[model samples]
Target: MKLRGKTCLVTGANSGIGKITAIELAKQKARVVMLCRNEEKAEKARQEIYKVSGNTDIHIILCDLSSQQQIHDAADEYRRRFTSLDILINNAGIIAGNERLETADGFELTFAVNHLAPFTLTLLLLDLLRHSEAGRIITVSSEAHRFARFDMEDLQLKHHPYSGLNAYCISKLCNIWFTRQLAALTSRSKLSVNCLHPGFVASNFGNSASAAFKALLILSQPFAISNEKGAATTLYLAGSEAPEHISGHYFKDKKIKKPSKAALNDAYAEELWEKSAALTRLELHKVSLS
Candidate 1:
């Protein structure tokens, strides 16, 4: 698909794969809106993207995804500034410290940012997306989802022993389920919703992780892919016509790949959707999931 006039919103656009994705979109002449938490880093990245892509149409929205109110405000701000949203990329994620941390909303930090943030933001922006000719939603999941021991009763990980890795894995698994459920709900619309594993790129992703986890990530860097390669699948899904008609699928290396068996469970997906809706206080009736 030609992106010359497309409007794409990418979360976490200040660094790592998200930054690369935003740069490429700008290169394609897409009007890129970068949603980031840090104003200084976001401005730096935006300037670099402009220098590299030579496209000054890039915009920024300050949002800390860990907060529900911030996510809502970000969405509202987008609507106030932009008319159409052709692509919405849920790219921001976090691996919290070894200790379990909660967001301002009192939810697990990882779960709140990785899953609920996108869930809330996407639903809030659904109307603008549907206003486009063909809207797309791409979420960044991970192979780590296979390690998730999802417990529907304890979605917040409050009852279980907390491990940063485990929480992150569970959040990634939720990403897939969210993608599936959202795709099914928006089937009748012009929206294409999908998720992907970006191949573990060597970047500053685990900076907030525990010391041990950070060391492990650093040690694994020699075997990890580059940021540009990590963003390839995202760019493919965002700009390529191949996935324009594809929805509810998981991709790796830009090809549709099966997610874990647990992620394929429709029941779990539905339950997760309901739980997420309740957590975000999203009225079911407001969503035209027909």
Candidate 2:
């Protein structure tokens, strides 16, 4: 898909893989929307993309993904401003410190930002996406999803040991589950949804992490790929031809990879969708899967 006239929104575009993805999309002449938590950082990144891509149509909106209210307001504001959306990239995420934290909404921090934020925002923008000729929803999941196993009894991980790594992995699994379910719902519509694992890049990913982990990330930076290299798969899924035809799949290195069995379970996906809808107070639309 040529992105010359497309409008694309990218979350967490202030730095890391998201920034590079937005810049490349802008280079393709797509009107880029950078949704970030910090206005100052987002403005700087927006200026950088505008200068490098020579596309002055780049825009920025402040959105703290960790808060449900902020995401809802941002999505509504975006709808009020833009008539249609061609692409939505749900790339914002957090790997909290070793100690578990909760968002203002009382849900676990990792789960709220990494998974629920995308879930709420995408559903809110479904109509605008349906209005477009080709609509794509690309979420940034992680290979760490393999470490997650669905536990209906303890969905919040309150009963289990509360390690940040476990929460992060579970949230990644939620991303894949959400993608599969959304793709199923929009199968006959113009919208297509998919998720990917951008490889470990040398970026500021763990700034909020524990000191030991931050040190480890710094030490591993020399071996990690550049942010631009890490964002290759995202750009492919967003701007390449016929990505809509390949929806409901997990990708890495621009190639489809099998996710965990839990990620592909139809029942689990549906359950997750229902739970997410309830948490976000989002009205669920009936999807004619027949």
Best by TM-score: 1
User: What are the per-model numbers of colliding residue pairs?
Assistant: 0, 0
RMSD of 1: 0.9
For model 1, what is the error of residue 125's alpha carbon versus the real structure, in angstroms, after optimal superposition?
0.1
For model 1, what is the alpha-carbon lDDT of residue 132? 83
Off by over 4 Å in 2: 286-290
lDDT of 2 by residue, 1-290 (tens): 78998999999998999999999999999999999999899999999998999999998889998898998899888978888899999998888887878889999898899999999888877777777787889999999899985485556687788777778889999999999998888788867788999999888898888788788888998899999999999999998654556778899998899999888889988999889988888767542331
Q: How close is candidate 1 to the true structure, as a TM-score?
A: 0.98
lDDT string for model 1 (246-286, tens) is 89999999899999999999999999999999899987688
